[model samples]
Target chain A: MSYHLNHLKELESESIFIMREVAAQFERPVLMFSGGKDSILMVHLARKAFYPANIPFPLLHVDTGHNFPETIEYRDKLVEETGARLIVGSVQEAIDSGAIVEEKGYNASRNYLQTHVLLEELEKGKFDAALGGARRDEEKARAKERFFSHRDEFGQWDPKNQRPELWNLFNGKKNYGEHFRIFPISNWTELDVWMYLAMEGVELPSLYFAHERPVFAREGTLLADCEYIHKRPEEEAAVETRMVRCRTIGDMTCTGVWESEAKTIEDIIKEVSIARKTERGGRTDDKRSETAMEDRKKQGYF
Target chain B: MDNYDNMELLRFTTAGSVDDGKSTLIGRLLYDSKSIFEDQYDAVRESSERRGEEGVNLALLTDGLKAEREQGITIDVAYRYFSTPKRKFIIADTPGHIQYTRNMVTGASTANVALILIDARRGVLEQTRRHAFIASLLQIPHLVVCINKMDLVDYSEETYEKIKQDFEEFSYKLNVNDVHFIPISALKGDNVVTKSENTPWYDGSTLLYYLENVHIGSDHNFIDCRFPVQYVVRPNSDDYHDYRGYAGRIAGGIFKKGDDVMLLPSGFTSKIKKIDTFDGEVDEAYPPMSVTLLLEDDLDLSRGDMIVRENNQPEVEQDLEIMVCWFADRPLQPRGKYAVLHTTKEVRCIVKEIRYKLDINTLHRNEEDKTIGMNDIARVVIRTTKPLYYDAYRKNRITGSVIFVDEGTNETVGAGMII
Candidate 1:
């Protein structure tokens, strides 16, 4: 073996390489961390990108304000750990500042609200590059994504008009005010990230594993019982301790959880290996329609 | 199943014609191996209802694009991820039609193996030869030819043996070493996940078993260490004002601290002092690692500068002989020059020679035909303005492969495997 459990090291080297390119090619680059496994992997990669040196760039979080407390706690601890600047583009703050208005009725999610806040953050920071943890295998639209995905000033992606990313030579060159959404892990699959985490011994939020929590059934999904999510009056709210964990974390309203008892990375790997459900299945935002992810992606929703 | 300690990824591309049972085979693998999620199965059932399909549409899980659903054709590459108990897999669900060979090449570039699907009723078709040749040209080491729809032929051992013999004789001209043939009915779920009881004549591991047990650990080029610097890590903060790290992914081989390395094109030598990530300084760095490397000797290195073993240097030349898969809707004109990108290095190139265009099927080289269209494979020489550090495609895939980008349209016109 070249190195014991070197998958993470290899993955880490690739991410660091991408991160360094972002800093050199763009005037201002922001790491769009959402406190998820992929983004967590992104942050961990950034640490290696500039080891013996702090993360040169700032971390940008487009907070929907409907996130789990544990994820936020994990995010804060990570930010504190690296000493990198944290820029929060808060949806709640945006609503308070009259920059964006919250939805009123049932089926409302701040997940969509994240777009406006994210665009505003890019405009405010004048960031030329924004790194995301988007993987191609996760979604169909993402499968058509480029490594240096170009975004218009309005933050729109015209899937039809994408540049050819040949070999490893990425074209990071862009006009001023035009930002790029770089996905270093664009080639990485969901299982690869989980395996890398296990190999690297990277810690994540407890919400990832199977745990007992208050949940309610909505549209054939197990949604965490939270106040921000609009629930119908007739819907029954029951607090049952069940083994469940989230495949993807989003605004508490939009993200769903599956009944799983995978507590460790090994257990999760086994569970993932056997899982036929797409990770986005638990994501309520994606369950809206067949092309929900595509529509959102086109509208600059990450 | 016991030893996964040296697990390495095996990405492969699948190419076949429509109704070749590509989707069915993949679905069978997923279903038998139980990779499908409960909700995914539920959605498949619901979609099947909407489509009025008699059985669950396994294609619904993989064919995620809407146009593909509406048109019943695959236009772009669809990537599917599945892991067995032993190895992880990234299956590039490329289109079978000739029009989408560009997508196939993109998928095949990183693949270690290629699964060529053929209908048992239509053995040794033109498209089958085309894909197999493409796989061989791309230097994919393993080839698993699945003779699907065996039930149509009544699972006759004679039919299987005849087809295998014919295929072997036809493919003898190509340099494919690790080749295996299997008979299965993808629709009936035979020999895909579990061993088929009907196939008493065939005594081989099931498709899933083969996929899981394949020896892929040695697929990577571990002899030559090459790292292309992507960005210079400079945390110009007061806490560490002097920290400078060269960040990049290792293109091939291994790297460790105190190892003497040289930067490419410039030939600047430096000793690797440390390899580290934000987590901490690591002991070593190797192929595919995304790490920041600190060098002891101060050197003028930037993005695109390759850090390689000072001793084992690759061929540095301006003229390149390559086998390329033409991928543009516009026909490749004679002597047309474009931007050639290999690894991180980019250089303007001139098409030196068109050479002979080979018919993918029949193994016939048509020297008379002067035109090279979409999905056509041909041998050609290219002259570059600057020197590139590369190896033969047979040696190192990462450092050997290059792509021709149309300068005006900025489209990747072709993917070339260096000779």
Candidate 2:
């Protein structure tokens, strides 16, 4: 009777409208899944968008071959439950095929190599549009992104030369070889995502909840003590069990955990409401430089 | 958490150059409202120190692109979000330059309010007129004129009055409906988040308070029922074999169950059987809510079709008079063929005639000059391949606007408002 939608419902409707637009506009579209909360939210919205019909497209996961065991398990279960087709783009295959070289150092990460594999897989699948869950509030560079972002044949983003998007009309037209990176949740913030997840009573990975894990202190951050991460002698000696949870999910070598006791969704919501740091503050991939995300985005890194 | 279900979303656009302290005002809003995280503040502080700035430069918080940071100017529209207990705000921060009119138009398309910043000492520059003119042309419901830099003018009542008078005199020719004025200093944080005592003569609320408490419930058109079908949902499974629903976001008016509706392009009349959403069925659906409508009788309907009230129907016309803002480098060729995207329909249109171009600064119509180039506003006539159901822009924004995409290049070239 109010005739007015709240902030969360408004955001949800906007995102659903965008996803339906993509389905109607593009010929061969795919959703990019990373087993993160944002991507999980995207899958849920997509399911609600076409209600009785199966999701009109498959989900593309660019696996870095170094992920938390729980993430892979969650991804498989979600795919099966949603009845969605899954397509994996493997970074390990690209590294073995000599398409990309893995970094060699104490802080080696396959995060940068995933872009190559993703582009190659897109080319293989002949997908014209790939939907992503990247939000504008995540990084400074992403703040300037449009809902329908165009990419050249080389899979590069030209930040300066973007189409002018007006109102709800989105122009998804492109050339033969070119494609677009569509973001349905470009307007939602980190806290909005958490609140929506909690409101819907959605299931998330156990990594998001606090649990005892072996972590080591590196650069004032608690990195999970795993074989994927190459640590120094002192770091190895400093490994200890701590109660921590992941604010975000990404490559195991790059994502850091926050020490916390918040276990339930309500506890996480309360924590996020009073948290003083941005969600990406714990992401090691973004700390390299001020324009690190911009540089990576230009090279077609989602 | 209790207020989460009742909070509203307000989107507004701000237009100003770097000197008007636009970035500083935004930073102050986020900081004072406890929206800016500590890490973001620390990053801005470090960047300021690296640039050898005297103090923490608030402008560094915005200007996201690498080139923008290096050149100290915003090239494109950047969106920023913040929320209070009562409302969540989205700021479409745009640059106020003569060449960036396209960017400003893009940002102003969806904004409920347009914030125009004017330097108190400068007193209504050309940029201010251009911004106000665009906001009015875009038909933004409300306008907030903030006379910035009150501290530089010593917070004098005379200065504020003079500037307010000047803006009012110029705004008389504009079509803006609701206008509010406030005096603030973005640098010293006076009358921005909290009211300032320096301006004891001023009786208006602060900028944040005005934004939070603005009346926007009546902004939507709720009298005419209009639903542009975007997609057709058909779940052909064993659980539900004979289900057909028209999915779309309501463009105008209110639609209730068992109401008589007519579909466009195929004039089939039917009664609404039910209104369905992901959560459950609703008794009625309103504007901006995406839902599926099930009719009592099965009718031939697809995308680009519209469901409207039987008594109130939009004008079906093949020829349209539109006021267009060109956004591409290539000049709009007379008698050119382009792709036109209306509510949920795509059709081909040819440029029939170029009536006249408007000078935004002087508010004069140039009938002699007919060349419409990038960042130019002109009146045009176009004929579509198929008739479109539309209303005047002033009547309903959602059902009356369109975009022209170049057929060859596939780029969005111009934005048009039905006249």
lDDT per residue for candidate 2 within B1-419, as digits (tens), equals 78977889999999865578787888888888899899999999999899888888887777789998888778888889999989989999888766776888998999999999998989899888888988999999999999999999999899999989988889999999899999999888898899899999988899999999999898889998899999999997887699898999999999999999998989889999999888889999998899989999888998998999879999899999999999988999999999999988999999999999988877899999989999889999999999999999888988899999998999999999999
Per-residue accuracy of model 2 over A9-115 as CA lDDT, tens digit each: 99999999998888888899999999999999999999989987889999999999999999999999999999999999999988998999999888899999999
Error of 1 at B356 (Å): 3.8
Docking class of 1: acceptable
Question: Which residue pairs come into collision in candidate 2?
Answer: none
Chain A TM per candidate, in order of listing: 0.94, 0.99
lDDT of 1 by residue, A116-201 (tens): 89989989999888999999778766877777888876888876455545445566655557779998887677777887788778
Task: For all candidates in order, state the fraction of native interface contacts they contain.
Answer: 0.49, 0.78
| Complex DockQ, candidate 1 | 0.44
lDDT of 1 by residue, B1-419 (tens): 23333455567778888778787677677677776667777877898889888988777767766777776666667667666656667778777877766777777777778999988888877788778887887778899999999999999888888878888887888889999888998888889887888899899887777887777767777788888777777767787687777777777788888999888878888889988766677778666666778889878887767888879998899999988888788888788989877776678899988888988776678888958898888888899988888888889887898888788765678888899
lDDT of each: 0.79, 0.91
Per-candidate chain B TM? 0.95, 0.98
